[model samples]
Target: MTRSTVDKALQDDPFGNQAEVKYKKLGCGFAGLQGIYYNGTICFHRRKVIYGMPPNCTTLVKPRRTKGSRSPSWEELQVKLGNLKELVESARSIISGDMLAVPIVDLSSRIEVAKEVSACSYEARTSWGREIGWVYGSMSEDILTGQRIHAAGWKSAALNTNPPAFLGSAPTGGPTSLTQYKRWATGLFEILMSRNNPILLSICKRLQFRQCLAYLVLDVWPLRAPFELCYSLLGPYRLLANHSFLPKLAPGGTTKGCSGSSHPPPGSSHSSPCYLKTVGLSETVFEVTRKDKSSCDGNGSTDEADKGRFTFDSSPVFIPPAALAILKIVAIAVGAWRVVAGAVEDKRGGPGVGEFVCCSWLVLCFWPFVTGLVGRGSYGIPWSVKLKAGLLVAAFVNFCR
Candidate 1:
């Protein structure tokens, strides 16, 4: 049967219903063959599909015939495995986008493919494992297990929440130290760095560094307050692409400063003294010109028509120090809110919210304390210190009110 016919047949059949369908390998040696199978069957003609292998191949063994050249060295295999791991990660990234709204089937498929590729690399390392005992052996397990666990947890949480509403709600711009983003990005960076994959490393860096910074200024700042201030500061300028202000950055518009400009104008006055000075001068001149032009036209400069073209390059549009202070206050409020939410939810006796948010707050609050204790303990400083600090903060807050 033609492709269209087969697709129609599959679509018409109820899931799990049996259908007598003909199968073909198209270009490969296998040709048209008739078969009756369940519609939802993963197996074809009573055999599981093997990826990247020809159909009806009986032997599960890899080709043993060695070419004139010797097999790759242990180091070479390790390098190859590392590259494969990076490729799998990149593929996963492409499939998941931001990991916030990925479909279950897509995520599962990508994870399965990643696991398969990872397994192949591990199998290839068996020979090398004999020479170098357990060095590269644990690498595959660490990657596969850690990634799968994280992805599963993330997916489950996302499913429980309403995505559109969650995303649409105004961000409570609160103070975040950029530490969590840095940590996650650093982990990915280390993996890619170890693999010596420059391309993946570059992508990771952009997402971690630039995107993280953007998220901090946008989502992290507005946690306790309505996003009006944050929106006023960033919405007019496309400082964050993922924000609602994206559509406003049309050609010839003033808001084009964010998306249209190659680099976002720095949010620090100290970084551009000349630009700030120029802005002062330009504002003065524009005001004078408007007054003169209004007199000449005998019609007051229309507010709508007189929307000035503020040159981003010559403007020192820093995040106000007040905004920063507001963010810190908001962060504290967010911590308090979390404590209250946790209590309320606990009282309700629903599924317990994990300590991730509380732990993150603790890290933000007592970063200095945790940093100082990093090298003093038998259990290793970072983990033990952070845990202790988190519990202490949570308890102290819980007792205060």
Candidate 2:
């Protein structure tokens, strides 16, 4: 069989978020370059590998031989496996690698054994989610589990097919998209901070150096939000107040009093408090992503009429972008008024083309929120969210004054 047919099916994820392409690129790089699996849903592993055996292991594992402890006898194995004689016999045969060698006479009995082991309590007090099977203790258990397997010196591969092996729904709108982003960010950040962190694993375990760097790229994504939020505010703050934080650029060289030493780095204090607060409060919580799976019936009426349009909710995730949009609008308006009133006497020192350009770029980044302000029905930014953003903008203006 071909690699595509033999390996786990490839996931054909629908594009929902604007940054979906970036995720795809990262996934491809991780799998192709590092021989590491990126998506949990698209990965396949040998049963022995899932049971914590390294790839090179050929013999069965032996239990620890302490003073009073020893390997379980056949009778004890029967009791621990289950009361079902068929299951006990099947387990013994499989452990000895002779299950397939014997012809299957009763298929129904095998099915019954499968059902029994599939029960919720089948893995209770066992090493299923702890040391043997899928690793637990994280929101993104799949990622952490895969990381551990790779750290154990096993390599993973990817399989691509002409037709995708699997198709998946993705979050379609702003609220769902942000919720998904939040969960992924929190989970990856947790992995970054945990003992299984790539740096520690590379040093202490067998995780490859390049693979560790690849994981770091994705794990550090959540940490960028605070920096981005701070960057967006600098443009507005410069325009509103007499004190400018960014260096004034000139044609020939740096301006007078524009030495890097004079200005305490822009947004240093502004982003630090928020960054610290976010780090302190970050928790690993799994949230279901809402997706749009609209289908057109014979009449052409669909459940989601505005499927491609950006939609809004009362989620706090929208608040920061909304407030930033409002701030940019206010700053631009005030800057234009300053130009009209001839209030900006100094072209060299005052808020000039650079600050306005930066603010305009930030406004473009928040275009979805800007457009949502005027959108109607479900596409509109909720009035409650607008009120909160307005209050934030007002507070920012007062602080600037």
Candidate 3:
């Protein structure tokens, strides 16, 4: 494998840190009562199933070495699995259900065979990525592929272990973390827009109805960023306008009336466009999350201190948070100034406490960005980002007026 390939593989936290606890609940949860979708990395599959065999198909498995049966010749195997001899032999064993068969132990040959089989011609005119192997409509291929398997009337199980069976490194830096989330959000958004979405799959296939809803929960998460952004801005708006958009409480009953970017999912590197664009079916580039081996070791390490610290980069993802933080800070300062100036003008006139509280709450929510504004070196938000955020804050202030 190339160094870049190894690095990419190392960075993939397929199951994530809390996957054990999370998947355990998923297994027992009502949505998973029938079956559950899981990451492709830590799962096994039936050979026939991967070879486009539907669950309803019935087939008898023959012994690997049955009486009067001659071993298939290379010519026949090649016809079935293309010209790749190694892949053909591998497929033969899998097809015979011979789990005890010894595996190819030669690392160099294994790599060579892997490359050959992965070549485009290996699956020419075949239903490999589309219908047989890992379905490839979305960036999040694992979930989509599993959804198709379940829709084909297959069920999945989640098995947990005492010490856990698998472990992988997660992104430790804020930029890498946000980039990973952006890629995921983009992929889910793509699934949501596709015909193979859980809702459609459930209606047209064997996927359970409740499972569809569960999938919807994740697929719709990225779309909520706008609503959340609007909600957060409300606090600052209220502070600036001295007006509460929320419904007022009355002693008798209550007054009814309450309602709710360069618009990227939070943490999109600055200058990057929105991930939910529907212009065309262009493939979205995947950003590998940065991982560290030292973080995985359970030893009482000193690096734990830095693990929790927020790290900054030139990515636009920090722009929203920084801008929001700046707006909140400005709102609080203005609110305080108004209160003080009003108090001086009259004995007891000032902006209401509720407005200040709301603005303060928003500040708390984005406290990290506020601190980053003044943080030193790489620990701080880049000046270019800060300048952009300041412009965004200024624009928001003008719009409020």
Q: Best-fitting candidate, measured by lDDT?
A: 2
Local accuracy by lDDT, each model: 0.27, 0.64, 0.63
Give the per-residue lDDT of model 1 (tens digit) for 197-237: 32332344322233223222322221212242333233211
Estimate, for each residue in 71-183, the C-alpha lDDT of model 3 and write its tens digit: 45445555545776666666666554554454757677588778878888788755567767788877678877877877777776656454546544566556766776677
List TM-score per model, in order.
Answer: 0.18, 0.75, 0.74
- What lDDT score is found at residue 330 in candidate 3? 93
Question: On a 0 to 1 TM-score scale, where does candidate 3 land against the true structure?
Answer: 0.74
Highest TM-score against the true fold, candidate: 2
Q: Listing every candidate in turn, what is its Cα RMSD in Å to the true structure after a full C-alpha superposition?
A: 27.7, 7.1, 7.2
Error of 2 at 132 (Å): 2.4
Worst 10 residues of 3 by lDDT: 1-10
Error of 3 at 11 (Å): 19
Between candidates 1 and 2, the one scoring higher on TM-score is 2
Colliding pairs, model 1: 172-222, 172-223, 173-221, 173-222, 173-223, 174-220, 174-221, 174-222
Question: Residue 366 deviation, candidate 2, in Å?
Answer: 1.6
Clashing pairs in 2: none
